[model samples]
Target: MAAAEEEVLGLLVGAVDQGTTSTRFLVFNSKTAELVSHHQIEITQEFPREGWVEQNPKEILLSVYECIEKTCEKLELLNIDRANVKAIGVANQRETTVVWDKITGEPLYNAVVWLDLRTQSTVENLNKRIPRNNNFVKSKTGLPVSTYFSAVKVRWLLDNVKKVQKAVEEDRALFGTIDSWLIWNLTGGTKGGVHCTDVTNASRTMLFNIHSLEWDKELCEFFEIPMKILPNVRSSSEIYGLMKVGALEGVPISGCLGDQSAALVGQMCFQDGQAKNTYGTGCFLLCNTGHKCVFSDHGLLTTVAYKLGRDKPVCYALEGSVAIAGALVSWLKNNLGIINRSHEIEELAKEVGTSYGCYFVPAFSGLYAPYWEPSARGIICGLTQFTNKCHIAYAALEAVCFQTREIWDAMNQDCGIPLNHLQVDGRMTDNKILMQLQADILCIPIIKSSMPEATALGAAMAAGAAEGVGIWNLELDSLSAFTMERFEPQINAEESEIRYSTWKKAVMKSMGWVTTESSESGDSSIFGSLHLGFFIVSSMVMLIGARYISGIP
Candidate 1:
């Protein structure tokens, strides 16, 4: 409407970051390479049974809409016209599978979250038929046979979900990860929706051939997923489609990537061996491998980092992911009542002298990357009567470092390259003590950017690159504005190795605590004390509630 408003609006390039725990929208000032306005909404996590995690696809869609509207409202208040939103970039949680009706564009069942392990049987069956090392899918897709990937989850849905089965029989079913689901909805859903996914996301699906850069029909058949339900594979940066209707209408959706890959881009780790570790619901470390895909001999995964354009050379990455990181802190807060808030863990941890020989192995949903032990349960070893809440808090933080060290070791063994430094981002990186400990444990410098929203920045950069804006092409002078904190390794190499050895021993002891026979006999000690702590805290809260009900302060 006004000239000033139009100028402000023109700077809006919305980035929709659909992550494991939440959906966020960030409006970026492309000119200054800064976030002008943003909004985030947490999505619901449904645990139907042990080791089964799910999320409603429709709820995700609603959260996306809410984020977009809230972000646009903030932009408007800043004198930025919502009409100026030029493009939308999407970065989403990888390997979480969703199945929907192709004709109706309605999800047949809740999205089977990446953390879900209900498909372990399916993965085990496939693994039996194909040797772990010589598995053609592993050689092509750079992934191991695990329930963490999308293939098994998709197969389980088709076999178990009745509506999905009906849709597949009628040839009206469509399967996608969160990225594809969001893009389909954002672009206009069944009417003219594009059933496509970026190469980075596709590579993690296990059904896609990383070498061929397309869906593997044989693999699809092996998993019993129909090829027709799969999305068309595309590059990470390109005009997939335009926003048909929203707060920012007519804007092209130019960039898409799996959340971890996007974070790598956001951290500006463009060179080989450059890596970034994102600590969120889970911790994912991705090391850029340039054009070469080095198959992991050390339990790491080889995956597509990003593809710039159609026919352009695709970048590969060696990745190691830890399934629990910041979530452990939430557990300490909500379950154990060790702290009133998640943030307070860092403070309490700082107050403690040390972990005092305690080690917390957070394998609540089983260990990931390098270990791949699905049956492994969490344990806290070396606990003594002297152990206090601070000791547990410190041990929880140290657990993240220990898991990261394992990943880093695996990456080195897989790639035959040493890392001198690592770029870090995400909410947990704000803890200076954790960063220092990460540096000391990994024996490498940990560098963190001032802007913790690296995932959103990465998606925006991909969108800008696709549009020829060169948002990432900044000079060192201008790059100084991108603040970074570097934490150098403080411990000696021998000391680091000794501590690591102790941690490995602790992990080994934690793994076999719960077995099939023991579980059936009701002798499973998997979450015994930990779960008891939760119940104790709940009962305490109930007592407090009764007091409040009786008008007691």
Candidate 2:
């Protein structure tokens, strides 16, 4: 009976994965490290105007709570007692800024999403004062000076939000990324909640010093954001606090990581130069550099991979992110009605041998990583009489590959060593055609794991490690069983190089197109304008078809 009780008590608890578009709660079996039960809730996005994307902070909180409760209910149905749950871990979207009143525990305004460009002007103004080389925060913090980070968003809130301003003036305002916000709420709101962020999440803010692993006062002053509002920085693993109430009452919150970093850990990329690419709303590739902060001379970012203890040197990484990967498929399905479902993209793409001469540069919300052009927009170029919907679909899939190739190139340049293979997981990787294309374009083997939910697995691993359920160096084969699909590079080096060359040309054309559109009408719907070009090309193809039918060449 004592042995039976010991076995039951060793089971893992539900980990709440608070993401950008949704929140998920997943329970894992500690012995096998497999998912037992899971639930998800979509979070709504509000685009008030062009370049302004926001989400209700309260809604995120509610969704997180709902996911945990629903997942726990499902667990109970399976006869798994909640008391057997050891700990709760959190993996959240990094850099989505939230500011709230420390007294009332209410958000001052809607949380500014990482994709939002509302703080563009603020970033631009700051850029003038802070040069990208000497004064840019990227050199110190391993992140770029973009509106995607929390610094500019936090500064924007303090300057614009009346309640936030009032709170700041009264010394009652607290600013943090979404993970900190959720942690604060989970631990019991403003009364006595611990305000903290993991090093991996903090590294993305452009305010934290990568070397020191602390918020840089110089950067804080440069952004005009008060340091008092910042949350205490903490390690990715270790007991941060205990849940005060609800479905996870009194459970220790043992692990925390930014979504991407957690996914890296989930993939078990423990060795230096081991990398993982998460194909989510965006595509991010992180290559661990182990203790060395290899700054990117290329347009990649340096970031903290994870921190195990306060005394442990933070693991570093060179990161490259493409803002439009899976999101491009979503756009093709929802906005253009080109496909019935997002997953159908691979099927449609495979129907065509290639994109013909067409190329789609999906710089929908500005380019990131290797190309840090904020003004760049989407473009589908080189359309001809033979171009069809299948070609367009293929081009869309190729866009993800091309962007990932750029990331791999930048990563190699920064790290001075090329990655042998890329470990990939995420919903988008389920598409075989896309994974093959990724491998072909990258000129490297792509490893698609059996478990697509690496983010949640990473969180669970961190929690398990913290609780002494597993060692960090424990064999991944013995832990979470993973079967990999290896997509080897089939194309020759010359062909790959030529394809990348064409991709770069298309990227330039896209960037120039954006500048042209902006200068002409200042219209923010740049994709709409680019689509008009597609229409015009389609009409030309129709005229050519009529001529061919009339016996003209």
Lowest lDDT block of 10, candidate 2: 513-522
lDDT per residue for candidate 2 within 1-553, as digits (tens), equals 2467547534765678888778999987766677888999988988665556789999999999888889889878977777667778899988899999989999999999988766766776777887546865766887778877888888888887788899999998998999899999899897689899999999988899999888999898888889999999988887888888787788888789999999998888877989999999899999988988888888888889998666556798888988888888987776666677888888778877698878888876778878777777677777666666777889998999999998898888777877788999888999899898888998889998887889988887787677443433335465546677899988898998898899899998766334423322335454534443355445445644534212234
User: Which residue pairs collide in model 1, if any?
Assistant: none
Give the alpha carbon lDDT tens digit for every residue of 1-553 in model 1: 4767545433556789998789999987666567889999988888665567899999999999899999989877976678766767899999999999978888999999998867765766788899656678788889988979998888887777799899999999988999899899889998898889999999989999998899998888878778988999999888899887677777888889999999998887888888999999899999999998878888899999999767669999999989989989877776665678778888878977488888888887778988898767777776554666677788899999999999999888877868878889998998888899999999888988888898988788787667443443423234337878899998899988988899999899767444433322233354532343454344444433433212233
TM-score of each: 0.91, 0.91
lDDT of 1: 0.82
Error of 2 at 508 (Å): 0.3
The number of clashing residue pairs in each candidate reads 0, 0
Cα-based lDDT for every prediction = 0.82, 0.81
